[model samples]
Target: MNEEINKIRELLDKIEKKNDVSEDSLHGTFDYFELPQIIASVIDFLQPLLSPYESVIYWFLFRHSIIETADRYIRVSNSQIAQGIGSKFKSGDKVKVASDKAISDNLRCLMEKKVIVIVGDTNRDGTLYKINLPEEIELCIERMKKSRVENTCHVEQKKDLDYYNIAENRLLIFERDGYVCYKCRKQLTRFSATLDHIQPVSQGGDNSYSNLITCCLHCNSSRGAKPIMEQFTSDSKVF
Candidate 1:
């Protein structure tokens, strides 16, 4: 009887292991978002401002540090960046790959534009760079705000706050709300996210950051001009 009981236990363990494996195979291989999706917002915002070579180099470093290595910083040589991005040079007779000087110049240009920052001094291995997506976006927003404020009086600035549409402002709202829809409590990507006015503009809402909230398109549209506090109170959902 003892021997029979031990055999049954071993058979049960095998069945459980097989079920776990089957479940993992069915569901564990898929993910809704990856590195590319996470970085898509930065790309969309900066694409128009970057040159062809600058964009290529940026993507190469982004893939290496963020996608391939899952790191926020990367050490890379100018030659490596040039080769990875297919920068070319004109030699005496044929078109050769970019020289280190050309690559260095472009890297410096990126640094000047605040797109990349040098994190470490040049060493025998390579120079380290930290990508500056969020910082760059913030800087862009600040510059625009400053320009607007300087060109107009405070009253005009407050009345015409169209800068709310800027990428940086949107990102700030999303970050403040933990990237979840205020109404539905669903996670949102930069692409799928929209901003809603807690106080409807039709009522008295201005474009001040405090009056804006991150929301999904469905919630933003469905809310229409309804007061947020009333809706939340009726639904018994705490904002």
Candidate 2:
């Protein structure tokens, strides 16, 4: 009886894939000439609204489906997202894949936010998804309008616009962390505060804002490549 159910499920998935192949092809002729503009919008607008996990999963799907192929539809699984996306936990010495349940929940959250749509049924291969671009998403559209982004097919990349390496993005992190050492609780200025990775980069941690913490130079250097320091009690502790 189990075997019969499995066969039926497989057959249905195959049929769904066959039907969606045309849907994918409809986008095959799409001119991706304006991709850079869309990329800028995703970075500047859409990304800020998504949770860290959702951002990682969204990028993974975007890279695999839209960037790798012209197809916006990609088939993926919760395990695939958990493994493919970069995340590290301090559970053990070795880097570990994020919990599958976290990925699944974030995927649902993304759908609820209308960032991605489930286009087809699931199978052994995985479920099919259609990634919605920033321009299509309501939140991004509002941001785009408020930013007064002119109607142009071309967009120039801004200086210091990316992660902590960039001046603008670094300032964002400092502001978010309140310019205080997350580990030692020491207050710091932008010039003295350095960003520390929650999960060390050596351990597969990413530069997402969620993974970054502000710390004084002493704490940043002292905690280098080590597990997070114990929460220090002295907010006014010097050095």
Candidate 3:
């Protein structure tokens, strides 16, 4: 453990000394893209929104630097991760070994949040499971790359802006709008309904309560990028 800590410290020193890296390089199994700080920032900002298993799974992918590829096509048996977590605790007397059931529950939580896609059963050949990061994660990855290039912490500020689109906020908006299309007054059973920014995101509108309105898929498509006021005044108004 001491040796591993020393190695990590050495790597941090190297990263602090050098600032050259690329997005592709960051995806490797052990490549340090000299943006550990930015990555850490993103994780810290997002950790509150993730479960313990979700956090572990994310770091596992990060260590391997396979977010994009994993999202495209990935697979891992439930038992594998469970065993991995168990092994991690075996060396520590104080840490409790995670049960298979606990690992399974976290996996389900991750799936429900769209953080990972289950490609197949763990009993299959490879126990395939694809990791699908949310748009916010992808944006964070991009911002990390940009920060490495620009040598700025602007990406940190953008984190809050991205938070507005998280599932919790979306759900709140859906509930506030009564899960019904504001224009057509059509009822929506659940998340199937679209969330239209009353002020339009393109026009600097936010995802706050005052700016959100629920709409059915058909109505949402018709509205497109047009501003709400414009839609109302134009013939495209669905109401």
lDDT of each: 0.66, 0.71, 0.54
What would the per-residue lDDT of candidate 1 be over residues 5-122, giving only the tens digit for each residue? 9999799767744543322121333233444445655565555567787778888888787666555467888878877876566678887787788788888878887878776556
Best by lDDT: 2
Best of the candidates, TM-score: 2
* Clash totals for all candidate models: 0, 0, 3
Span of ten consecutive residues with least summed lDDT in model 3 = 19-28
At residue 131, what lDDT does model 1 achieve?
68
* Residue 238 in model 1: lDDT: 53
Task: Put down candidate 3 lDDT per residue, 1-239, tens digits, no spaces.
Answer: 99999999789657633432322122333323323433555464445568766788656654433533422344565556655553455455675556778777887787676566554444343444544332224333344344344532442344344324665445444444445687787756232556887777888987665566677788988887877777565665443
Candidates 2 and 3 compared by lDDT, better number: 2
Which sections of candidate 3 miss by over 4 Å? 1-45, 65-72, 90-97, 136-239
**Candidate 1, after superposition: displacement of residue 137 in Å?**
3.7
Model 1: weakest 10-residue lDDT segment is: 22-31
Q: Between the candidate structures 2 and 3, which one is better when assessed by TM-score?
A: 2
